[model samples]
Structures are given as C-alpha cells and as structure tokens.
Target: MRKFWQKNRKTSLAFLVAALLIAILWFFFWPLNRVVEAPGEAVNIQPMVKIQGKQPLKQNEFMITAVSIAPARPVSYVHRLFDPHIDIQKTNDVTGGQNNADFNNVQKVYMQSAINNAITVGFQHANRPVTKQYHGVYILNVFPQSDFKNRLRPADLIESINGQQLTKSTEYVNYIKSLPKNAPLKIMFKRDGRQMMVSGHKHDIVKGFNGIGITMIDDMTIKTDPKAHIDPGQIGGPSGGLMFALQVYSQLTQQRYQLKKIAGTGTITSDGQVGEIGGVDKKIIAAHKSGAQVFFCPYVKPTKTNLALEPGHQTNYQVAKATAKKYAPGMKVVPVTSFDQALNYLKTHQ
Candidate 1:
C-alpha cells in the first residue's frame, strides 16, 4: 500500500499544478483576450431610410395601418443575453398597471387588450395572419363631413369597409382607393360589442382620390382577452406600453412580429400617443444587440408625475433624459401628446 501511494504522488502533484495554471490563465489572460475580441462591433451603422420625393402629407387624407395587441411576456433568450439586467418582471408590472385614460401615459393596455382579443378570435377562426402592423404617417386633426360625423371615434374597432372584411387598416385604405368617384361605400365597425354600419361616398381628387372629407389616422388595438384574468384597476399609462402590447399580441396570435425578428420600445396610450419610454440607454443597448431598427418613444411631458411625488417625477425625467442621450441620438424622438400625433406620424412615414 505504501509503495502504491508513493507512485501516485507525482501524478497528483502534476494534476494540481495543471489545475492551478488553468485557473490563473482563466482569471487573467482569458478575460483579457475576451476584452480584446468583444462579441460585436463597437460602431453601429443603421440603414438609411429616405423620405425624399414622397408627396407631402395632406390634412384631409386619411392614413391607416394595422396594429396588434396581446399579453406582455418575458423577453426572448437573445434579449436577456444582451440585457441581462433587464427587469422583465418590473416591465410587466408597469405595463399591467398602465392607464389608458391618461393622455400622457398613452393607453397601451387598452390597445393591447383589444388586439389580443382580436388576434385570438382571428386565429381561432381563420388561422391566417389578419394584420400587418406598421408605423403610419399622415395629417392630424381634420374633421369628417357632417354626414360622416360621429360615425367613427378613436378605439372603434373597424370590422369592414365597402363589403370587404377589413383584416388590416392597409387593406381598408386600398379598398377605398380602388373605389370610383361618387361610389357609395359601407363601413362596418364593432363598438362595445354592438355592430354598426355607416355609408359614405368615395371622392375623386387630382392625386388619385378616395374617401370624402374624413381624415383617418393610424389605428392600432390589442385583441381583447376573455379568459385571462386581469384587474381593471391595475393598468396605468407607460409610454412604451403600446409597442410592448403589440409584440405580445403578435405572439399570442402566432402571427410573430416578423418571427420576433424585430424589437422596439415605445409608450402607448389609450388615446394613441406614442410617448417616450424610460431606460433609453439600457433599452437602446439591448435593442441594438437584439437587432432592432425602430425604437418608439412616447411623447410624455417631462413634468408628469408617476406617484404624485417629487421623487417619482425626478426619476422619470432622469430616465427619459438618459435614454434620449444614449440610444436614439439621430433617431426622431417623436413627441406625441395625443393619438392624432401617433396616427399622423405613421401615415406619412409608412
């Protein structure tokens, strides 16, 4: 036994020395090597999207786009890896408690819920993608003719236009564009579960005309949830809530917001303001790593209070300022005080 132990002693010593060397190399040289060869390129270059030569947006021209809304969930594996410090739970909490009534908060929860409900129904019935969510840009604040007055309102779920079942807003716009001058068209919508139909005559203009006097903004909604339990009182306004809601809705409908290929952040209100979101710097870093080109910022007043206290207001401003300085330097930090701003922006931009 003594002879056996003596023979293994050298082997054990060699093993110990190798382990120590490996530890030292890992502690110093390995980390230094990683620092030298960082995972991604330091300088980020975005593709140039040109808005030149596009026709100037007209006030009476209605622009519409499809949006999806659904449940807010955990970030994907890629997002987590890029921003390991992201508090998804906190984000969810904030979204869940968002308020739609507040113009400043931008009614994200309500919109998300609307989209979720719609997607669930559409998926259960059609098993096809019903909408293509995109940012729109158009003119804001033009009233429709008296004949069309009170026929539409913000948050009204448009079911169809001109006998064409409208799955997306773009489809509706295209349908309207196809109609001839003085052609009578019927629009069907669902509001509070009551279906209503209205009729309007398409108009002709020199620039390939369509519908009369009605100026439409981009309309986005979250499908409504019939089963998932949510407290009515908990939801409050947060600027990026709309984008988050849409992402969730797209997931629930199995439509995939481009197979989760896209990532963005913005604040949504019930009234449709895309306000600036907090944690811009961290979110930008995370989004850039996740390959997000579009980032949505809610147009919120810097003085808005989260807790009716000075500390909360200060913190909100600090986060907003930091975000502006870090992630979206050249990007337009759209300041939307109402849904009209968001809708108009989407119309002209899209």
Candidate 2:
C-alpha cells in the first residue's frame, strides 16, 4: 500500500496544481471582465411637487415631470482588478461583482472637475448672474446652445434676485418664474469677495413660463481638520452637496438630520431641498451597497423626452435599475422635492 501511494504522488500533485491555476484565473479574470463589461441603459422618472407663492394672494403652482438619468461611461473589468482601495475579490463575492474603489474614486474626481468646468464656462458667456467681484464661483465653460451661458459660473454664490435675498435654489427658480414675461430682471451675486449685479430679460421657452437658459451650482466648502488631509479630487458634483451640507450643518450646529443610519445623494440648492441629480441609479447603488436604506432622488424631471437625452444619462439609468432590481428590491427609493423632504424622511425613518 505504501509503495502504491508513493508511485501516484507525482500525478496527483500535477492535477492539483492545474486545478488551482484554473480556479485562480476564473476568480480574478473571468469575474472581473463581467463586472467591467456590464451593459447599462438610461431611464427617466418624473417628480411631482407644489410651489407656493411668496405673496398670499398669488396662486400656487404644481411642478410635475422634470427628471432624467443616463449612463455616462462603463467601468472596465481591468479597472476593477487594479483598484487599490477596495478588495475586488471580496466585493465580487458580495455583489456577484463590483467596480474597484480606487478606479471609481479617480473617475469621480475627473467627472466632478469636468462638470464644474462646463458650468463655469456656460455661465461666463450668457452675461446673466454676472458679478464684478470674483466670488468663489468662476465661469468654467459654456455650451453654445444652452440658455445658461454667462448666467452663472462655478464658485459664485447667489446673494439675491431683484430686491429679494436668495437663500435657496427654489427661491431663485421661483424668483425667475415670478418675473413679468420678457421683463428684464435684476440678479445680484457675489464674485471673489465683492457683490455685483447682472440684468437680463426672462425668456419664455414654454407658454406662460419665464426662464433664463442657465444652470447654476453652488461651490461647496470642503472641511478638514488639522489632523485630516483631504484631496480636492474627492470633491465631485453638487449631487452630494446637499448631504454634505446637512452633515456639515449637523456637525457645526446642534440640528441633527439623523443621517448616521441614512445615506442620501442629490444636488443641493440654497433653499435646502434635494435637487435631481445626474447619476441617480449609480448613486442609489452606491448608497444601498453602503448599507443605506432610504435613497433620495432629485425632484426635477426632463421637459422634452429626446432633447435632454445625453449618453451619460442613458447609461446611468440602465445600470442603476438593473443593480437595484438585483440587490435591494425591498429598499425604499424616495424622491425628494427639497432638502426639507430629505430631512423629514431621515427624521421619520430614524
């Protein structure tokens, strides 16, 4: 028996080595490719909200159907394998597969910077939201056809509209909408450290509605203590702005949003409501994976189906839906109209 066992040892060892190699290759390469090459699609969900007028006698308006999402780019399998921060093998075991955290973090930084540049350039040319002082907001770049050109830029803090003080995005939107059709409106904003004013006539894109073809974003202040160093690249778009603001506000003041157990994603305006974000589905997946129960989506919806459609929007929606359906089917996806709604949801759920 001993002689027979010794004789077959070499053959058994060779088979074991071959099996191990195959297993290692399948675990690392095969699953990595699947995660990186996953196909995504776009989706649009409309939100409903009621806007109250500043004056008692003025009639209130209901806002419906104004949000959209699409995929921007796909994360490749090679990218996930090379990620430095997260253990890709562990993630694959948990989610069937996942993107590498290092790759995602870098990509987020680039995307954030690009969006900021686009908004800056767009506001610089439109000549609206123009301020003489260089408040933090800088005009990055402008799209030729977008109505928002030269209206507002990155880092600019809107101080007021007309004579009214602007405290939130809803206030700014309502102020613009309340103007007399085609009437020249006064916009006051801070640039650098000084205050400046710009004038423009509101254009009516849809009948009975007035608008300036500008999209504005607030420049958020990054917080870091003496012991902690943060990378600027970590700053992304205004989508997480509201959550960051709430977190910051909670830290500074005693007012708690009860957000420790809750994770939310959305753009924030000054008025404190969560605005619709671009990568709702991706953000939702991230939130869910992070152990968050309630997901907040921006209340804004797309106006025209085909016109606002972009490649990124299409991809984001597709991946988001598929990921949600597969992972957190019972999780609540809450649509937020404003910061108030988000805060309320958090408080109630907590």
Candidate 3:
C-alpha cells in the first residue's frame, strides 16, 4: 500500500507540471483582440529633409515624435496591467477593421500626404515658389456594397474612371454623379506601383447620385523651386507634419533656430494650420525621454460642432502639458494653433 501511494503521488506531480506548462504557453501565445499603444522614439527631422542646392542645417533641434502601436497578445495584457503608461485599445478601433498590412499601407499614405502638405506650407512661408500638381484620386476607403470591394483597397491610386483621366477627386466624383444609375464603369488604378484595372457599376452612394462605392481624396505634389526630399524611413503617420514643415522652413530660409532641443507633434495643412493629433501623452513622454527641452503641441478653440460631438474633450496641448509636468517637469510645453505660431515661437525664443 505504501509503494502504490508513492507511485500515485509521482503521477499527480507529472500531470500538474504538464498543466502548468500549457497554461504558460497559452498566457504568452494566445492572441487578443486588442492593441497596445506605448511611447515611441523621438527622431531628429533635420537629416530626413534634404533640399537641392542648399546646405543642410548644422544643428538638429526639431524632433518628430511617434507612438508605438502593436497587436496585443496575452503577454501584452500582462505588460499593460503592470505599466500604467501603456494604453490598450480595441483592435477594431485602432485599425478600423483593417488587417495589419492594410492599416500600415494607409498609414504610409497619410505620411506621404503630410509630407506634401508640409512642403507646401514650408515653401510658401520661406517666400519660395511652390506649385501644386494634382496627380490622381487616391482611394481611401471602400464600402462593402461596392462591386470593387475586394479588388480595391486603401492606398490604391485611381488614375482614371471610365478612362476619363481625372486629376482631382472632386472631378472624379462629379463625373460619376452625372452618370446614369447603375452605369458600367472602368477604373484604372495603381497598387504597389503596378497599374491595375477593375470593372464595376456605379451605385446610389448618395442622394440618388451614382458613385463607385469608394471614398477618395486628391493625390498631389508640391513642386518647389528648390527640390526637397523627405526620407522618413519606416516611420508612418501624419503626426510628424509640423516638425517636417519646421525642418523644411528652417533649411530653406537658413534660420538658425536650433538654440534648444525642440520637439513637437501636430498635423500640418497646406495653409499652415496645425491640426491636433492622437497620442499626445505618449508623444510627450517620448519627447521627454529624448531630452527635448521644449515641446510644441496643437491648441485651438473648439468649434461648436466639435464641442457638440465630444463633450469635455481635452485638447492635445492640455494633455501634453499634463504629461510633461508629471514626467518631465523641466520641459516647457508650448501651445501652437498653426505652423506660423510654432515658427514665430521659435523665432522669438531664439
């Protein structure tokens, strides 16, 4: 009876070990339907922006901040539980039902658009000649009812509709609107640098008007007197718009505003408007960790419509200020409503 009891005890221990190992594996490997947002790196923008027939800025003061986004697994939950700074969000909310590859492609498009907008703003501010050249309509989103749903995706540049070769998205939409309902359509588009064609029929996407069941925006380039090249590496998103514009303006005008390490986050418009962006707290933390002395964030009065949409909403500057105060009290947080504001701030501080 003693030997039998000892054998049973050994078997029980073996079973317990196996169960423990399985639990550990599940805890680490199982995928979750969430994503983690953490503070990313702050990169100097001077080297990334190169202008022809001009000397590169010697000082690196402007920095572009990014937030690291990753799919959450079981391990990510553990990390988020322990780290208060990390944020967890629904994957659908972050990606808008896009897979990882599709979401990344959309981000790349946003980054390109931001660069072009920044170039336009910077060149105009520097008193340099800049011309806007419209390319084609860039597809941003496709609806489920669209016949080209599976064939077309975001980041695809629709070069023409019905072989009309429209340069502006508005023109494409107008042309489609004039067409008869359920009219057969031919779309010539470019994806991954390869020109592709799709045939479909326009549907009643709005007010009884026919549309391709896809949303599009204009794709264009800002041709400047001094050609500019921006190489952002793997960094994607429009959060770097303000910093890109600042760097471009500084290089073109040769203004030495590198008195201190300046880091910022905001999206730039062609007319120099600095739009608010997401992940302000994460960006501030990143800037602080990178030794930024001054941080610029978007701050503007809320429009009546915006206030109605989101009550008690905090502006990016407000969030950035609080984060900087808590994590890096030595850092100064400056509010900017437009690119000119940020530029003037640098000029006056210098």
Task: Quote each prediction's TM-score.
Answer: 0.32, 0.39, 0.90
68, model 1: CA deviation in Å? 26
Q: Write the per-residue lDDT of candidate 3 for residues 55-132, one digit (tens) a residue.
A: 888775789998998777788877978876798899988887777788788888889989999999999999999999
Q: What is the C-alpha local distance difference test score of each model?
A: 0.41, 0.43, 0.86
Q: Give one digit per residue, the lDDT tens place, for model 1 in 1-350.
A: 99899879988999999999887665544421111111121111111111122222222211111122222232232344675334333322333322333221235433344333433333333333333343331212224442455565444556666667655445666777677767887877765569888886766433564465544444443333322211223233232344433322333333322222233345443334444444444544444444443444444454546435433354433553455456545333344454444334544563
TM-score of 1: 0.32
lDDT of 1: 0.41
lDDT for 285 in candidate 2 is 50
Off by over 4 Å in 3: 1-3, 180-184, 204-210, 308-312
**Best-to-worst ranking by lDDT:** 3, 2, 1
Highest lDDT among the candidates is held by which one? Answer: 3
Off by over 4 Å in 1: 1-110, 113-142, 145-147, 204-209, 212-238, 242-319, 322-350
lDDT, candidate 1, at 347: 43
- By summed lDDT, which 10 consecutive residues of candidate 2 come out lowest? 42-51
